[model samples]
Target: MADPKGFMTTPRQDWPRRPVGERVRDWDEVYVPGALLPIISAQADRCMDCGVPFCHEACPLGNLIPEWNDLVSRDDWRAAAERLHATNNFPEFTGRLCPAPCEAGCVLAINQPAVTIKNVEVAIADRAWELGLAPPRPPDRLSGRTVAVVGSGPAGLAAAQQLTRAGHTVAVYEKDDRPGGLMRYGIPEFKMERRHLERRLDQMRAEGTRFRLSTAVGRDVGAAELRSRYDAVVIAAGATAWRELDVPGRELEGIWQAMEYLPLANRVCEGDLEESPLSAEGKHVVIVGGGDTGADCLGTAVRQRAASVTQLDIYGQPGADRDHEVEPWPTYPKIYRLSAAHEEADALGTAPSADADARLFAASTLHFTGDADGRVRELSLVEVDAGRREVPDSTRTLPADLVLLALGFSGPDRGDGLVDQLGLAMEPRGTIARDDGFATNVPGVFAAGDAARGASLIVWAIAEGRSVAAAVDRYLTGSSRLPAPIGPYDRPMVV
Candidate 1:
């Protein structure tokens, strides 16, 4: 264990992000590169290493947080990476993107700020990579079986890598031009650089996981035909059916889906486009939704030199501090989260609101008003209570040259014909149905990730992928040694 008194000796500290004024001018990540390595050991020492270690139960990947924390605190970067990778396939992505529910489960959080587990995880993984610890360890022999993985997000990639290491042939099919489904396009570069993703892809390729890009499993290649070709199939196609607001003027030219607008900016990062077709340049942008996706749009708009930007949320803002009365210790609380994007948005704000933040909480959109040329010029909104009952005489209008619907996803993309082709059973909650082993209704077919669950974080996606691969391995050989990380219906530390 680390120093028993270390928690009391060291205060919780995090990596310093780049200045808002400087980061908004470029697509680089907000964090300072290699700036946390020296102090990360002190931060890791802050872990209490409790007897229960609720942090493990809180993580979907069931990461050995205490073990790795101890290793990091002792300056054992290679061993820390080993303990982290034992459960998680991609620590780099999760360390940067996940909300860190493990911190909420930390016993130290009961009194003081939680240990910077995410930072320690990233520091270990990145240091191991720098020291050439992440090399391809190809399987000694072949299993003589082939697996087809649909979608190339975190889940599909995790499944593919695990299956390949298990000595089975794996081919990942992606609808988009690139292999990464959402990670390639949905996420903004300001949050995470694309190089991290590219390096991992290269490692997977070195281990013999083939990628079939721009190949839709249901459209370009028939799902039925694919099932016959491969011994087994894992459908990790994420929930992409965007939830929409059907209010009036939704069909205006300036309106777009979050998926639609986010990818355009990503294309610019890919050098495929000099500028996004729907760039918010010189426009007043209004982003609907208060989640991380909405914050991403706000940051992207500010980077695109928008005249002004505002984020609207249907629910009232959460408390600044955790509500222990409603969600007590070890539970992921719904506190007001000011993401890095929100901080950047604050520095870039042009108008001064009453609350001094760009966010408009407890707000509801009524309708949009377009110009004579049928382009959206403004939108109408009103205030509402927690019950969604409208407040009297609260109607207001704001100029909006561009309107982005970041209202989140409803379910899997049904229009792509994957469901119709496979005849997969779907739950009423708009997710693909699967058994305890992650197997679908169809024999020899399985589902995982957001396709089987609702829209969730990347940690859950990678966990589901790793779990489903073990099931497929058992199905193929009638017995296997791979570890199952989660059940089809398992959720961790969800408040």
Candidate 2:
């Protein structure tokens, strides 16, 4: 209500990204620093503050979008940040990384462009950090009840922070040498800088949440022993078993999984590694699967100065514009997306000529042709039919010195010693099966995030973690006071 006619007066303005040529030289984030603050207030004013905000229902965390929008429009960034952090534990992460389904579900989007909720969120969070509003909230008193949270991703971190504030002693266990799971390792630095992840981790540590890095529960300590040592155990181990393209010549020296390639690039950016083992430098790279992972690889390869890059997808091409008939307003549309990586690649003149980001739809890989030295030289492919069957007459070969299988993950790796030692029951889809309360078949052990749910958004992971913590808190105290952001059966609004 800052301005009743604000929506009509101001049009939605998106946050500006850095110049493609300048940003590609290094691993800094694509967004230009201090670029959004100038226009963010006008963008925030565009919020309608609807009678029944659909954006609330769209967000898993039930973020106070309208309230914060009003606060930001009035130049009250401190209050805006407070309102944002009231529900979401880490707005900085989600604001930068999340696809912003809430904007799709906005009431304004029914007619005009939606409010720039994501940009406003980032502005609020950045302002909070500048003003020192984002301080640690250590609990006033410790409950003396101990909780062991396994995982250092968004879910486990949110759960640990919430439980710690609820007066419980919490310890977060991460198998990796550093914390932040996928955020630290899986995500590229150019997409989201590591400083953002580290700053949030610093706050969490200050809040009395103890972190045990490089210590996996099932490996370092027995799963049963971990359960016995703590009053409650919450498992937030993410889904990491990658889905592979089972075709001929899969064992070639240059053919690698996306996880193998992406993490190495990330580690190199962190200065922890000398060089990536599967670098695309001076090589023609072919990425199979046209998802976010593929786009990430495309950008990384371009940065590494790949000789050429091509991406393939089994599905048909998506419409350039939004499809109103198939994917209507108030829901996330199935349309062509031009991510920051795509923009950078397009500017470099190395992008594919298909009017998109080096993507070839309705294409399936046949096999890879290898050089005499056992390294991949080229990839054999064919046009896919309506049923995704390869057509014989449309066969072709593309030169590729390196091949990355960006074909997404299946679920958590069951072969990991942790799942076997815990004897956790898994559903048919390979996800750990939890009861109504997010408790597994075991009495006191609970599961959450990508481990219980399949591969999902960071917001969903945090919501699941918060909900599972409430369930564990109630189980320990008979009755407890904690916010359950989502239930066990809850799915994302966009998905």
What's each prediction's clash count?
A: 0, 0
Candidate 1: global Cα-lDDT?
0.90
| Candidate 1 regions with alpha-carbon error over 4 angstroms | 354-356
TM accuracy, model 2: 0.97
Index of the highest-lDDT prediction: 1
Q: Which ten residues in a row have the lowest lDDT in candidate 1?
A: 348-357
Residue-by-residue lDDT tens digits, candidate 2, 1-495: 798899999987898898988888889988988889999988988999788999998889999999999999999988998999988898999998888889988999988988999999988998999999999999999988999999899999998998988889999999889999999888889888998888988998888999999997787888889888999999898998899888898888999888889999999998988888888898988899888889889889988989888888888778866677777767788677889877776777664533366777788999888979998898988888769987779888888899999887767776547787878898988888999999999888899999889988888988888888889889888876888878988875543
Lowest summed lDDT over 10 consecutive residues: which window, candidate 2?
A: 348-357
1-495 per-residue lDDT for model 1 (tens digits): 678888999988899998888988999999988799988998988888788999988888999999999999898888888888899888999999899998989899998999999999888878878988788867899999999999999999999999999999999999999978889999999888899899999999999999999998888999999999999999999989999999999989899988999999999999999989999999988999989899889889989999988889899988878888889989998888778877877776643441436788889999999999999999899999999999999998889999999999877898878888999999998999999989999999999999999899999999999999999999999987877878987876545
Q: What is the lDDT of every predicted structure here?
A: 0.90, 0.87
RMSD of each: 1.1, 1.5
What would the C-alpha RMSD of candidate 2 be, to one decimal place? 1.5
